[model samples]
Target: MRVLITAATFRSHLYPLVPLAWALRAAGHDVRIAVQPSLVGDVTAAGLPAVEVGRGPDFMSELKKSIDSDGGTPPGTAPSIDKIVVPHIRIAEAVVADLVPFAKNWKPDLVVADPAAFAAPAIAKAAGVPLVLHTWGPMPDQLWADLTSERTARENWPKDLVAFLDTWNVELGPDYADLVVDPCPEELLAIRMAKRQEARYVPYNGAGVTPDWLDEPKRRPRVCITWGTTSEFMGPEVLRPPLLAIEALAGLDVEIVAALGKAGRELLGDAGEQVRVVDWMPLSMLMPTCDALISQGGPGTVLAALVNGVPQLVVPQISAQPLGAELLTNSGAGLTLRPDELTAESVVATVTELLDGDSVRPAARELAERNAARPDPTQLVATLADLAAGR
Candidate 1:
């Protein structure tokens, strides 16, 4: 069977689809990731074949600039639904023009896609194949959209997206999923969609190695801190969390391991011999050794921590990150701090509270166990095979 996977032009969006792709390939199905030209390398890096489609701009840059131009998100508010979804829609539209043609040529039996990858429906419709939407961890974006759409048409994806794809000859709608694959624990989700298929999360942190420090015994409580994955494209200003995190917990006896991107690594100067800063280390490996995690609320990052049962302190920056922050806090598995609320004192207090108290540990551990109990991706291959074979 031939499987075609599609994603928005971002690593966070692309990574969620990898596990299933891996499962399909292992089962002897041909799988190729269809993405914008720039993301082809990421697909290949994950050891899958990539088919380059239409052009797309730097969406992270566009998102950063859009947020900056609006003077950042309001104190109590996240960036608007349009601001977040529009960039994805734009890139998805760009990929569709080429994608429709490719799907016709490849004639994939199934199409697996990121929920945000709006182009997949057109491909599924064009090729007369089954389309399945896969999610990335806690999906606050969809929750927010569902809530906001109730009050205004602007925030509704199915309505707005259907109208947006008017030019395409095929019948396309955002509601076009034959099955929905979810890896997130129910505790982390606020809203549930229809036709959901439960799948265990397989973390795909791009091209990596096990660090040497993993072999060393921890002399104290270890904390894993990261700036999430999108900061490099946004530039240095977005790299402040790691610096502030170091400051917040400076006098504490905890060992800090900061996983940063290229910009974050450069921005972080010498933080003494106690701090371990690596440019790219998978949190899946690091979270198991840590006592707590502190980072921005990117679904992928937080889910990595959650899967390992690590208590978290999220500093939400953009889009549905705040929504994720709220759900985590409600679940008692984690805590949240808005950008305005972030401070040395607050971070220290939260970190200490999570570390010193056993309050959230049970919930965090339960959530992890529940997520681990979900059907693995290899198991989902049969489900997809059935869908492809019209079962």
Candidate 2:
């Protein structure tokens, strides 16, 4: 069987699918990823075949432009409709058009998609294949509906704007997908996505092949700071404060490992000792040894920390981050701070508390065990293969 996966261009979005894609191939299925051309290298790096879809500035570049024009830092909220949803909708349409010609030729048996790329389901519908929606975070269906209703209800929108906004809600009706895979956990999505018969709560997909470094010794209590793939679009103004806050913990006995994406490196160059910036590191390898994580509240990062039994301090980038952060806080594994209210003093204070407190660690360990106990995705893929074959 051949499977086609349509995902956003971001590494965070595409990376989670890599393990499962490999699992499918190992089980004798041909797997191909349809993503932005810019992400081709990453797809190939994970040893998956690449299917290029769409033409536009890379997703993050367009996002930066959106911020630059919108004035200063984005307000804290669920990803702004303009920032994430609209661009993705455009990218989805472009990706669908890009994939249609190939779909006609390749004739894949199944279409797996990241929900943001609405066109994947559309393409699957056109090709008449089983559509599987893959997610790293809780899929916010109600929030999506609210956003759609708000846009359509806007009397201020120009006629053309109203039509474009209506396009945002196109995926809401039937003909969406056959199944939705919430790869995080059922507990995480219980409040947000609820109990939908179509939804399956699988474990995290990209758990990563453990690296040899896990056996080595290190002196500094390693601290990981990351914002994940879309960090480039999320300006440093929102992220830097947290780092400065960490730096305020100057005398704390920890080595701060800031795994910055490209944008973070550019913004906080040579912050001197007590801070180290790497372009990227495989968190699966690094998180296990880390003492604590200070992050911008991306779900992927939050889960990585929790699954590794590492506590976290989240200064959420937006509402989704806060939502994930809130889950962590509720689960007793982490803490959250507002970016606007975050100061170096607050960061130091929070980090000190998390590191000094015993409860967070036990909570983190409990969460880790819970995550580890979820179904292995390789087995799930085997089952999915059977379903796709109508077994």
Candidate 3:
């Protein structure tokens, strides 16, 4: 079988689909990732073949420019749902034009796409293939509704596009996929929007060498602090100023691993020995050794921590982070602090609570058990094959 996996031009969006892509390839199916030219390297780095389908203005830069002109909030602050979906719709429109021709030529049997890849439905329809909507986290039906309504009016799309648009109109449903592959735990998910296939959230934070220190037994309770890779785009200011969390945790008994990018590391000046700052390390490799995690609530990071059974203190910076944080808090697996609420004192208190408290870890363990119980990508290959064959 031939499969085409599509994603928007972001590492976060692309990474979620990696496990399944690898699974299909391992099962002897031909697979290729269709993405913007900028994301080709990311796809290739994951050891997958990539097809660069579109060319145009850079989406993230345009989004940053729009955010700056609006002056409503800082760069990393979460945008309104309108802001989130419009740019994606614009990118999808450009990509789909290129994708349709490629889909016709390549003739994939199945199309697995990121939730935000608005072009998937149209491409799948044109190619007469089954579409699977794979999510990094919980489905945001409201955001999809807003996006579809705006696109339907603005694009005045053709009849083939209507099926995708109609998906947004339906209540409590997935947006035009034959099957939905969700990685989030059932308890943490906000809604079940489709006939679903549950997959465990396997962390793939790019291919990297595991550090020697990661294998050594820890002398003290370890806490990982990461703002994720988006911090490279948003700049260091996206995190709390003056490195409040690191400063506050200075005197604590715990060892702090600050897995910051170059920009984020530069923002921290002369931190104490207790804080070990490195530009990049795989969280999947690092989290299992840690007692707790302090993160900006990226779905990958949050789920990685959950899978590792580490309690978390989430300081959401933008986008779906806040909602993810809330769900984690509700599940008793973690606690959340809004951007405004983030301070050195707050960080210290939260981390202390997470470290000392027994309830959170037990809850985290429960969530982990639930997540581990879900089928791995390798197990789901036969089901996807059947769907691709129109079974």
By lDDT, the best candidate is 3
Deviation in angstroms for 251 in model 2? 1.9
- Of candidates 3 and 2, the better by TM-score: 3
Cα lDDT tens digits for candidate 1, 239-330: 67667888778889888888876776677778776788788787767888999998888899888888888999998887668778888999
Model 3 is weakest, by summed lDDT over 10 consecutive residues, at 166-175
Error of 3 at 51 (Å): 0.8
- What is the descending TM-score order? 3, 1, 2
User: What would the TM-score be for candidate 3 when compared with the true structure?
Assistant: 0.89
- Candidates 1 and 3, the one with greater TM-score: 3
Q: What does candidate 3's lDDT look like per residue over 33-74, in tens digits?
A: 999999899899999999998689578766666566667555
* CA lDDT of every candidate: 0.79, 0.68, 0.80
* TM-score of candidate 2 relative to the true fold: 0.83
**TM-score of each candidate?**
0.89, 0.83, 0.89
By lDDT rank, best first, the candidates go 3, 1, 2
Q: Which stretches of candidate 2 lie over 4 Å from their true place?
A: 60-79, 141-175, 190-215, 229-231, 262-273
> Where's the lowest-lDDT run of ten residues in candidate 1?
144-153
Runs in model 1 lying further than 4 Å from the true structure: 60-79, 141-155, 158-160, 169-175
